[model samples]
Target: MQKHTISAIICLAGALVAAAIAGASFLAMRKPDLIVRGPGVTDVKMLSDWFPGLKGTPGDTEVYILKGADDGASMLVLGGTHPNEPAGHIAAIMLIENAQPKSGTLYVIPRANASGFTANDPQEGAPQSFTIQTPNGPRVFRYGSRATNPIHQWPDPNVYIHASSGQTLSGSETRNLNRGYPGRPDGTLTERVCYGIVQLIKKENVTITVDLHEASPEYPVINAIVAHPKAMQLASDMVLGLEMQDIKISLEPSPVNLRGLTHRELGDFTDTLPVLMETANASQGRLRGRTDEALVLTGKDKWYVRAEKLGRLYVPYDEKGHPLEERVGRHVTAISELMNSWNLEHPEKPLEFEGLPGYEDFLTKGIGVFLLPLPAKN
Candidate 1:
């Protein structure tokens, strides 16, 4: 064979190999992560049950219900609104696997944006999945994109307009589930998912709704709870309760002008008092050093430590760094305190639950202790 022809053939072979690897990764991401139900899960339903428009679509997600025998108020906890924030999802999973309501109903949605888990955000060197060392062995979970998968919703316009309030944001925000609230029934896939959540809150008569999330360590809202105006009193009391436990957290009222957000829209549309909590996550921060599974699990980024010294970060940072346990601990603790505050204020419609691990428990035992082991294959 001619020398140039032989060289071209070799290049083609390399290209084919690269394509195959990429294709395999894409297919693997499409597989959903396993979430074993626990003793507390009394019933399992789909988001479509509340809003049938999402039926037979990827927008639908599981809703785990833990209803107490006694009648009382109901609360909904949302996780995985942004799949990149693992603590939110992990905390929700922990609740599903452990919490048993005593006098009220607890609804947990581990993955609010189901489509987001199918892919990673572009240009971010985030791992597709990360594994935790459990007592039985290891359990893997996806570290997915911040927005809904482009495959489900595409063609971002020049300006993404909020449906109810004429607020405009960057076109990319259209794919953001957090920015698509009080959604239209016939809107895009993300908006449809949002609509379904609203439907669930309204149908279930949920008194309190909490959305779990994480922000970059440098973000001003880190270690804070953003609550709707109606939920301020409840949130204020919860913050104090958390502070008493040595878990410092701030309180921020949901911006009235910020349209389409859960705290703003959910409160305005439904009777549910909406609150959102944020934890500091260095792995998602721009100043992070390495972007890998270790960074996700043990958020010890040297660059963030330097940034903290420069007074560029909101939360205190040191060599110890903020581990996954700490972040998830904050979320779980906040949820428990919020429930306590609500029950105290409205004893007539009290909410109570047990089996949720406390902050000290997480710090000592680690998050893996709360996560249930996977089921054996048939």
Candidate 2:
């Protein structure tokens, strides 16, 4: 063969090999994670069930409903408002697998932003998934972007205007599920997911809605619960309940100026008392170093510890690190305590459940003990 022909063949072969590998990775990421349903899950429906508009879209996610033996009030719990915040997702899963409603119905949407899980955030050097060792074996899960994948909803405008309140924010926030509450029926995919959640709340008459989240350690809202004004009492009681157990969580009232948030829009648009809880997640923080699966699972970073010593962080940090166990534990406990506060305040219309792990159980045993090992393929 001529020299030019030989060179062309070599280049073409390399390009084809690269494309094959890229294709495999893309397909792998699109493949859904294996989430085994537990005994408590009585009905499993898609987000599209509430808002048909979400049908056939990546934004559609699973909604797990566990009904008590006796009828009572219903509560909705949301996880994965930001896919990078793994604790919220893990805590929601723990509730689905472990909790059994005692007096009311428990609704859990573990991956509230289902599209976000299909890809990692660009330029963050984050892993596609992480693993937790179970009693039987290892269970893996996706580590996704904080926003819906750009592939699903692309080309953000110069700025994002809140449809309901006209509040202006960075254009990229258009894909942040947390910023699209009481979502529009004909809006972006993220907005539609939010709309579906709102529809479910309105249709089911959800008494209390809890949105779980994680913030950077330096963020002021870390280790805090921000509740809508109508839900203030219940949140305050929840804080006290956590304090009694030495969990040390704070309470923040939702700001009136901020629109599109669950605490703000959900309360304004519906009867449900919306509350959001945030944990400290160093892995997603600006000060994080050596981003990897271990950092995602352990929440450990010398940089975070140094920043804490410099008096920069809002939450306590040490060589021991926050760890996924502590973060997930706080969220799960807060959820249980939130319901406890509701029962204490409204005995006649109480919300109660069982089998959720508390602080100590997660601290000593780790979240692995709570996860179910995936069944082997035949």
Candidate 3:
């Protein structure tokens, strides 16, 4: 064979092999992760059930309803709105797998941005997946992006304007599910997902809505709860209860000018009283040293510790670090307290749940114990 022909054949062979590997990886991402339905789960539905526009789309996600025998109010909990926040996602999973509603219905959307879970954000060097040691074995879960996957939503504008309020944000935020609340039915994939959630809240008559999230430790809102005006009283009572239990949490009013966020728009547009909670996560910070599974799970970072000593962080940091368990614990406990306060204020419309592990349980036993082992078929 000629020299050029020989080189061309070799290059073609290499290209074919690379394409095959890439195809396989893409297929793997398409396979949905496992989430074992706990005893409390009374029914499972799709987001499209509430908003049909999302049917057959990657934006569609599962909604787990845990209903109690007694009649009362309904509460909605959203997790994975930002796929990078492991604690938020895990807290929703834990509630699904462990909590038993006793008085009202508890609806959980653990993967609120399901498309985001299928991929990681580019340039973050984040792990594609992480493992938790369950009693049976190690259960794996994807670590995804903060925004909807670009594959599902394309071509952000130079600046994205909030449709409802006309407030503008960076174009990239158009993909943020939280920033698209009270969303349009025929909008971008992220907005459509937001629209579906709003429909669920309105249709279900959700009395209290809690959106779980996390921020970089350096962020001022770390370990805080942002409550809408109507929900402020309930949130304040819950904060007081959390403090009584030795769980310190700051309170922030949802900014009036924030156009598309859950606490702001959900409260304004829907009947549900919206409250959003944020926990500290060092690994998601810009100052994070090495982004990996260890950083995601262990939450120990010397850089963050030094920054804490320098008074650059909102939350206190030590060698012990803010492990995943602590962050998840904070979310779970705060959720319970919020429900408690809501129940007390609205006697006729109460939300109740049991079987959730308390702070000490999470601190000592860790979150892995609650995760179900991977299914044999999966």
Quote each prediction's TM-score.
0.97, 0.97, 0.97
Model 3 spans with C-alpha error above 4 angstroms: none
Writing each residue's lDDT as its tens digit, candidate 3 over 255-299 gives 998789999999999999899999988777998888888888888
Ordering by lDDT: 1, 2, 3
Backbone clashes (count) for model 2: 0
**Model 1 over residues 1-378: C-alpha lDDT tens digits?**
999999999999999999999989987998888988988899999999999999998889999999988889999999999999999999999999999888899999999999999999988899999998889889999999999989888888889998889899999899899999999899999999999999999888999999999999989998999999999999999999999999999999999899999999999999999999999888789889889999899888889889989999999998888999999999999999999999999899889999999999999999888888899999
Tell me how candidate 3 scores on lDDT.
0.91
Model 1 sits at a Cα RMSD from the real structure of 1.4
Candidate 2: residue 93 Cα off by (Å): 0.4
Q: What local distance difference test score does each model get?
A: 0.93, 0.91, 0.91
Clashes of each: 0, 0, 0
**Cα-based lDDT at residue 86, candidate 1:** 96
Give the TM-score (vs. native) of candidate 1.
0.97
